[model samples]
Target: MRSVPEWAQQRGFGIRVEWGRAGAVAIGAGAAGVVVIDVLSFTTSVSVATAAGTAVFPYRWRDGTARSFAAERGAALAVGRREVSVAQPWSLSPAAIRRAPFTERLVLPSPNGSAIAASVEGTPVVAACLRNYSAVADWLLQQGWGTPARPIAIVAAGEQWPGTETVRPALEDWLGAGALAAALLDRGIDTPSPEAYSAASTFTALPDTPGLLRTSASGRELISGGFPDDVDLAVDLDADNTVPVLENGAFTDHGR
Candidate 1:
């Protein structure tokens, strides 16, 4: 088997940052925990749902199988943005989840964020978004992570190109991961890999987060598709304090 080099693994860092599900796997084993950021909506939806006291199950496939997956767990499945209706109010849109009636549990399927969250083996995973990055750092610190002995990796779940498996790195997720990294550093978890540092710097220097999101490609796509509210809700920075921690196959509130 091929080995992940010490440098590639970002060895000796309290905090590390990498992109996509593959990045999670690359740095996951040596780390104490993983933070998954999907700002364009997966983690954002999770923040909104968990803030409402709902348990969220991350599912990798958004298909007919998702129904069976949710049924097996007795959870309501979140669907596509446009698929949301009065009867099926749960969808990937953070706005939709926020407006929907609260369910005890929800199955949120996404190829990016959910895939990374669920695929991390034997590691604590935290769902992070612009709204709850600081809260996630608080939860991690309380749990004694973000040390050299208990390193944490922040995985930015970038979007996939249409009709392809290729990843198209999104700026929002990068900034979201950076936001978390910056929060950790501000709290004295100063050992960050260069990659994590870059992300942290990017977030720290961001002058207009909401404005940037409004003009981002993902934001423009959502707005053009008539889900401007999703974009709005996504950029609600530091507005939430709920940290959704993935435990036993579901994300539960681990807030301070």
Candidate 2:
């Protein structure tokens, strides 16, 4: 039995955490609610846009120049990479995105992971990361959240190589998912598998190595390549407690 299941067996809660797309897809297919994490920024932007009450038209820029496009359109943009620079303006906080009027459009540029998370729609989409795990869990539990037959799916945006098929899971995303799973288990939910526990534990046990961020594939590629500030922002935990929820075509910090 996995640690989460074991824990759930003892506590009577049914929560589980899984690693990778396979697990996430399984849960999404079976669950009523789904939370996707795109720490790099895409998913975050989607969550923010939805929370702010605007319909999101998620589009990918082949040249990765969405920022400029958004600027040209007078839409607010947030850089999700590490290292903020003077050349880039309109940088704002997650809270600001949540509080902004729902009509404003958001153009988010992250390292390379969050876009997939934006693809999930039919059901309400909420941003999930270590930063908002607790607040999100509380909100979910309070509503007696869950479809009797459908499970909740949490998708973590992993690092993807530009022209390759390889996509690596980031430590932060894994840890964030684990934390969310733990919170769900705390509320009497189903438990995840052994792999989930191992993944979460591995991330949690990291010793905070010097230049660890610089060494990470996503951090290194994005920072050295152009989005230095996004790495730092993505890793920040508990920066915002507001859980953005999707409503109509947009999202609002207001819980639905």
Candidate 3:
């Protein structure tokens, strides 16, 4: 399990990392702010779609409910698969959303992405990957997400399936979370854990890597499945820093 106290102290924001299903629920229930990391593609696409001001209705079904719903409303859909490459510097524009009706939804079917979206039902949801780390940090600071009472929690969408070995924690997600914690600490917060510092320090040590896709489990899986280019796409930092907000059944760009 990721360390929550270290993040809380380091960022001066109340940040925690939960390891199990119950922890996911606790964070989602507004116990703290949540950041779900599914680096493979699902969360990334949701972030892009939401940042573009589109409503993202993430369904767990493989039968095409999300696609059909989006088609019914005329929304452009981005289909997600474990083997597809994550598009670089991707963005969904507000104009595109305007072209589609309410029935249209972006159907993102991934092992981790959709699950994270579904977890955070009523809290402020933002997509975090190596690509938008700094942008996300700056945006979070601007929004006071690291304030004392408002804690930030990162949810890593580990491999969830029958017969799959336990998904080891990815280095990038921890580092990304650490960087976020460090940024928060820079704003006069109180993060004191060595682990948090270590994670943030690791990210700073290697600033050249664009995003987490190159060094994450999800990214590796996609590559093995045939999308090697996606690793680079998901790691570009600050390429687009639009903060995605979940409302009703979709995500909207909350950036100014």
Candidate 4:
């Protein structure tokens, strides 16, 4: 793959939106901050844990090292959805985090959102979901981001195919990215790149966000996979106030 062209960076725009890891690298360049969206679960789970006053450590690989990564921090390692048991209840599922016994620190691993969040450096990284888009946008604006001088990059952590590295841009994440874009616009930060505008418009033009989320490909996957509560929590729009900001390799609430 070639490097993303200069024009494709959404340069000069106050708000930019892009898909997958490559998009994050492209738009993230020169931006003041990056907001990662994975509405199906990852970011939603971050919101749940952060709101509970827990710090989340985002890990890219789910291999054997994840356990050691958690162990080094004295944090609980999140298990697979079906792997959650009485001894290890924390998983990527938002509902699972909500029900799990409280822990001050947690290591959450994923190839999608967590990968994007953990990999981004230099600028601040924020975890945003439908549950706390408003708070995120508000926090960004408060920090003087989303301006011509300090642009904001919003990356939608699209899903990957079962056995491939190809990105499957999920509708839920697209809309989740748009939700924050729209909130930025509503808060008087009106300059969005064309891609960001399209995402924000898609969000505002929708009549039933909850319905759409419930029926999205990723959403349905969770429902059929016996984790409907996660989907339910992801659709809880503006339901939270905690904004998880990546600092020192962990997402700690920028508690407003």
Candidate 5:
């Protein structure tokens, strides 16, 4: 664990990868932009929804207040995978969110990705997935974010088990973040931290990303939950150019 100043002094750009809420808070303050990657579903869903011209509001938890929160914002609440149907237009299932009727805004609550995104404050936050890492990397470079003065933090929103206080690092999210880091490294930013380098290397080494995601722990869980289509949607590399950036308590398409 290197200190922040050390990172700033050693590299023109600090490309650090973190695990969950604690990781988000640790690196978020100094980051010019924070890319939250929840490859299993959360960020993937946001990317799909925003690309289809919808705004997404991220909520930390799916509880009793989620419905009112969505209603107050004039947005629909995205239900869990089990609750999804034609009547429930939005859900954590990326496939469902992609095919649902167009919505101007939707409130998506998740115990993992959405929680981490909402936990980050005062930093420009963006959602990234394997499907749109290229676009995200391009957009970050265009904003001059990877330079030393303006570093970027790529946070992998790993899953959490109920009643657990620690983060459960998900392989899919790690690969997703690694893909974005690899994109940045390829674009001429070469100061990623050791952990970041490892992640990038892992992604680059994977010959078949979608195939691996389909068999990962998170992927297997989603498959058992009857949301295998969500995993399929998540692995579509460079599928869209839309970047869902958090702004004014909502995520809207930043780079379209």
Candidate 6:
């Protein structure tokens, strides 16, 4: 019953995966749904917020715009990880935000994940991290989204240095994407793209994910920045079953 154009677009893809902004636009164009995985924090934060029954608004990390953006939405802007405190209600740290007093809505800004998420045009976008990869995969399967005829694009929202346009793929996100890809494979979805297969293979080959994540570059950076707890929280694979899906400009728990 679907229109020709819509069906054509869905049939054009078969489990493609890519990194950062380019993937947000290019791969999102044809895929049935796009999954944005930013394990260092953004997607992880979204998973935590949605798990707590809150909606999260994605915003690009601009110094002055975030406040006004949140104000316009009648939501609070989440602070940086280091800015989180006992009195601070929200922050980029997933562990911290998970414990904060629950708010109905929040605007979370990031240079990578949030930016790519906010920029995605028409495709349904889902946030994924190690904590909720299996949950997301199960949700996708329930939605019948990972079929061979209607593939998904799993995007790793890699980190970008300030004042630069280029982004470097983070190992954490690569593994996060791989984890989701592997989950889909377990459900009988075949990956046509070698990139997706490689990512899944990389994740499956890891024997001690949590131990390894502690030594990742992003993990070390977070630890050095006073968020050692966040790295530990990020590697808690399948810790949650909430799938945060972006809808009407904010991420809310799927099927809610």
* TM-score of every model versus the real structure: 0.97, 0.65, 0.70, 0.98, 0.93, 0.91
Q: Which ten residues in a row have the lowest lDDT in candidate 3?
A: 88-97
In terms of TM-score, the best-performing candidate is 4
TM-score of decoy 5: 0.93
Clashes of each: 0, 36, 15, 0, 1, 0
Q: Against the hidden true structure, what lDDT does model 2 obtain? A: 0.53
Model 1 weakest lDDT span, ten residues long = 1-10
The order of the candidates by TM-score, greatest first, is: 4, 1, 5, 6, 3, 2
lDDT of 1 by residue, 1-256 (tens): 1566666788788999988877887777679999999998999999999999999999999999999999999999898988888888999998999889999999999999999898888888899999998888888999899887899999999999999988999999999999999999999998999999999999999899899989999999999999999999899889999989898799999886
| Pairs of colliding residues, candidate 1 | none
Give per-residue CA lDDT, model 4, range 1-256, as digits (tens). 3688999899999999998889999999999999999988899999999999999999998889999999999999999999999999999989999999999999999999999998887989999999999999899999999986799999999999989989999999999999999999999997889998999999999999999888888878989989889999999999999899998889999958
Candidate 1 Cα misplacement greater than 4 A, ranges: 1-3
lDDT (Cα atoms) of all candidates against the true structure: 0.91, 0.53, 0.54, 0.93, 0.87, 0.85
Candidate closest to the true structure, highest lDDT: 4
**Candidate 5 regions off by >4 Å?**
1-13
What tens digits encode model 6's per-residue C-alpha lDDT throughout 18-99? 8888766656665788999999899999998999899999998847889899889999789887677766669888888877
lDDT measured at residue 256 in model 4 versus the true structure, 0 to 100: 85
Cα lDDT for residue 230, candidate 3: 52
What CA RMSD would you report for each candidate?
1.2, 7.2, 6.2, 1.0, 2.6, 4.3
